[model samples]
Target: MKISAVVVTFNRKKLLLECLNALRNQTYPLDAIFIIDGPSTDGTPEALLECGYIKELPPKKGNWSWETKNVIYSPINNKPIKVYYVRLYKDVGGSGGFYEGVKRAYEEGYNWIWLMDDDAEPREDALEKLIRYMNLPGVIALAPTVIRPTGEISKPHRGILCFKKIFPMIQIPLDESKYKSNQPVQIDFVSFVGPLIKRDAIKIVGFPKKEFFIHHDDVEYSIRLRTVGKIYLIPDSVIIHKENIKKTSLIKKRFLGKTIYRIPYNKLWKTYYGTRNLTYLGRIYSKSKFKFYFKLLKRWAVSVGAIILFDDHKIKRIQFITSAYLDGLRGKFDNEKPKRILYGGKKE
Candidate 1:
C-alpha cells in the first residue's frame, strides 16, 4: 500500500528530528513525508532543509484543478518516495495542520496516511505492525501503543468503557504484558498521533473539524469514522511520545462578566480542547440517549469547579467554562479563537 506520513510540528526542532529519523528507519517503505510547520522562528525550517531526506514543495493551489496538478507534482524525478514541507504563517493550531495534511495526502493519491505529531517516534517496526493488522476486515484506522518517556506504555480507551456523570478518571491496567501480545483490540477512540488511516475512511467521514483548533477534533473525527468502520488499537505497534505532560483542569468557570483562563502556554491548550470537545460529544450523543446529556452536564460542572478552585486563572477559567457550556447548549460548532498574546503584552 502507498502510505504517506504526515507530521505537524511547531517549535520542537530536536524532537522533530528524532521523529523524522524514526520515520526514515521504518520497516515499511514510506511513499511520502509531508510536514506542516506552524511558522517557527526556531530554525526548524533550516534543520528540515539540512535533513536532505525531505523535498520542499510549494503551497497547494487553491483552484479545483489543484488535485490534478498535485498528482503531476507528486513524482520526484520518478522516485516513489517524496518529501515536502508546508509553512503556514498563521497558527491554525494542530487541527488545522491535520486537516491540511490529510487533504494533501488524498490529493497525492496515497491509499493510506500515517498521522503523527512532531514528538512521536515510532518503534522500528511500528508501521509494519500496523500495516499487517490493518488487513483485518472492517478496520479503518489503527493506532500503536503510546509510550511515555518513563518507559511506561500509555493505554487507549478500549471496549465498552463509559464515563460517569462527572469526568472522573477511568482507571485501567497499565501493564505492558496485557498489550505485549500481537493481538488487535477494538477501541472506542484512539489518539491521532501514530495512527494509519485508510483513504477510504477519510473519504467517508472527511477530515477532522479544523474549527476545533486542537482538542477533541480527533475524538469527533474518530466517532464519525466509527459509523462507517471500526477503529483498532494494535498492541504490537508502539511509538514514544517525547513531549512533556502538562496538566490543565478539564473544567471551565464563569466569574464576573468576562471569561478568564490562562492561554495554553506550552501544551495546556489540550486540556481546554479536551474538556470543551468532550462536552460537545456528550451532547451530540445525548440526542438519542438522554443519559449522555446529563452525563455531559455533570462532567462540565465538575470541570468548572476544578478550574475555579485549582487553576491559576480562576475568574477567566470560570468564564471560559460557562461559555463552553452555554455554547454547547446552543449547539455551537465553532470554538472562538483565543486572542493572541504578544510578548510583554497587556494583561486582562
Candidate 2:
C-alpha cells in the first residue's frame, strides 16, 4: 500500500521534531509525509528546513481565514521517499488539520493516509504493523495502542457507550506479556493520533467535521466512519504519547482547587466536546433508538453541572455548555468558535 503520513503541528517545535524523527525511522516506507502547520510563530519553519524532512508553505499576510498549502519533500536515502508539508495560515485546530490532510491524501491518489499528532511518536514498526492489518476485510481505519506517559496503555474499554447509550465496542484484547499484539475487537471510538485510514473510507464517510475544533472530533469521525466501515484498534502497533499530566499547585489548589479537578490534559476539551457533540449526534440517531435521547439528557446534565459547579472559568464554561446545548437543540452546527481560556476567571 502506498501510505501518506499526515502530521499536524502547532507551537510545539520540540515535540514536532521528535515526531518527525520517529516517522523517519518507520519500517514501512511512506510514500509521502505531509505536515500541516498552524501558522506557528515559534521558528518551526526554520526548524523544518533544518531537519530537511519538511518543506515550508507560503505565508499569508492578512485575513483570519485558514489557508491550505502543501510542501513536498523526498527522503535523503538512496531510494528516496516522497514527503509533503501542508501549512495553514490560521489556527484551525486538530479537526481542520486532519480534514485537510485527509483531503490531500485522497486528492493525491494515495491508498491510505496515516493521520498523526505532533506529540505522538510511533514505534519503528508501527506503520508496518498497521498496514499488515489494513488488508483485513471491512477495516476502514486502524488505530494503534496508545501508551500514556505513565507507562500504562490507554486502551478503551469494550462496549462503552457514546452519549451514555450502549453501542458496539471494538475491544482489542491486551496481552500482558507483549506490549503489542494484533486482534480484531469492537470499539465505539479511537484516537486520531495514530490511525491509518483507507482512501475509500475518507471518500465514503468524509473527513472530520471542522466545527468540533479539538475535542470529540475523533469520536465524531469514528462514529461516522463506523456507519460505512469498521474501525480496528491494532494491538501490535504502538505509539508513545508524550503528554505530561500537569500537577495542580497547592497554593492555587487552596483557592479554586475545589472547582478545578485533575483530568488528562488531552481529555479536558474532550469532556466538553464529547458531551456537546454527543448531544448533537444523539439527535441525528434519535429515531434509530429511543435510548439515544435519554443518553443525550444524561450527557447534557453532566456537562451543565461540570460547567456550573466544577469548571474554573464558570462563566465561559457555562456559556460554552449553554451554547452547545442551545445549538444542539436548534440543530445549528457550523463553525462555532469556542470562548478562549475556559478555565481561568477574574478574581472578585
Candidate 3:
C-alpha cells in the first residue's frame, strides 16, 4: 500500500533536520514525505535546501497560498523517495499545517498518511511496526508510543478521554502494564505525533479543524475519528518527542490537607488558544445546553480565581482569559485577538 508521511514544523530548524534524517532511515520506506513549514523565520526554508531536502525554496504566492516544491531523494541502493516541501506565507499553526498536509497527501491518492510534528523522530522500525497491523479488521489508525529523550513514555499523547463524570473530563493514559504488553491497546485518543491513519478514515471524519489554530485540535479530531472505526496504540512502534521544555514553576500553598497549586503563565497566547479551543469543544460535545453554559461559567470562575490568586499580570491574564472564554462560547475562531495579546498590541 502507498503511504505518505506528513511532518508539520515551525521555527525548530535543528530538531526538524533530525526528524527528517530519522524518516530517511526508516526500515519501511515511505512513498513520499510532505514537509509543511509554518512560515518559520529562523532560516528553516534555507536549511531544508542546504540539507538537500528540497532543491529550491518556492517563491511566496500570497498569505493563504502555500507554495510547494518537489524533489526526489535517491539513496545509493535504496528506492528514491518523493519529497514535497510546502512553505506557507502565513503561520497556520499545527492544526492548519496538518489539515493542508493531509489534504495534499490524500488528494494525491495515498492509501495511508503517517502524521507527525518536526519535533518527533520515529525509531527506524516505527513505520514498519505500524504497517504490520494495517490490514487488521476495523482499525482506522495506529500510532507509536511517544517517548522522551530519556526513554520514558510521554503519557499525554496516547490515552482515553473519559466522560465518566459530567462536570469534569479525565484523560487516563496507557499504564506501564499496557505499554509492556505485546497486544495492541484500543484507545480513544492519539496525538498527531506518529499516527498512521487510513485514507478511508480521513474520507469519513475529514481533516483536523484548521480553525482550532493550535491546541487540542488532535483531541477534537480523535473524537470524530473514534466514531467511524478503532484507533489503536501499537506498543512496539516508538517515536521520540523532542518538544522544547517550557520553563515554568507552580505557585502552591497548603490548604486543608492538600496542596493547592496554580500553573504560572509561560506563554499567555498558548493559554488563550487552549482555553478558547477547549471551551469550544465543550460547547459542541455537550448534549445539554444548560450544562455547557454551566461548565463554561465554572471554567471562567476557576481561571479568574487562579489569575487573581497566583499569577502575575492580573489584568492582562484576566482580560485574555475572559475574552477567550467568551469567544469560545460564541463559537468564534479568531487569530488576531490572540496574537495581539501575545505580542504587544492593544486588545481589539
Structural similarity to truth (TM-score) of each candidate: 0.77, 0.77, 0.89
> Sorted on TM-score, highest at the top, how do the candidates line up?
3, 2, 1
Model 2: lDDT of residue 310: 41
What are the Cα lDDT values of the candidates? 0.68, 0.67, 0.83
Cα displacement (angstroms), candidate 3, residue 258, comes to 11
Residue 82, model 3: Cα distance from true site in angstroms: 0.7
| Model 1 poorest 10 in a row by lDDT | 64-73
Query: What are the per-residue Cα lDDT tens digits for candidate 1 across 195-233?
Result: 789999899888878777776677677777788888788
Writing each residue's lDDT as its tens digit, candidate 2 over 257-314 gives 4544544322344445544555566666544556665655675577677555444556
- Model 3, 54-164: lDDT tens digits are 877767566565555565653523867888888888878899999999999999899999999999999988998999898788999999999999999899899987643
Indicate the residue-level lDDT of 208 in model 3: 90
In angstroms, the error of model 2 at 274 is 4.4
Query: Candidate 1: TM-score?
Result: 0.77
Looking at model 2, which ten-residue stretch has the lowest summed lDDT? 339-348
Q: What's the best-to-worst order under lDDT?
A: 3, 1, 2
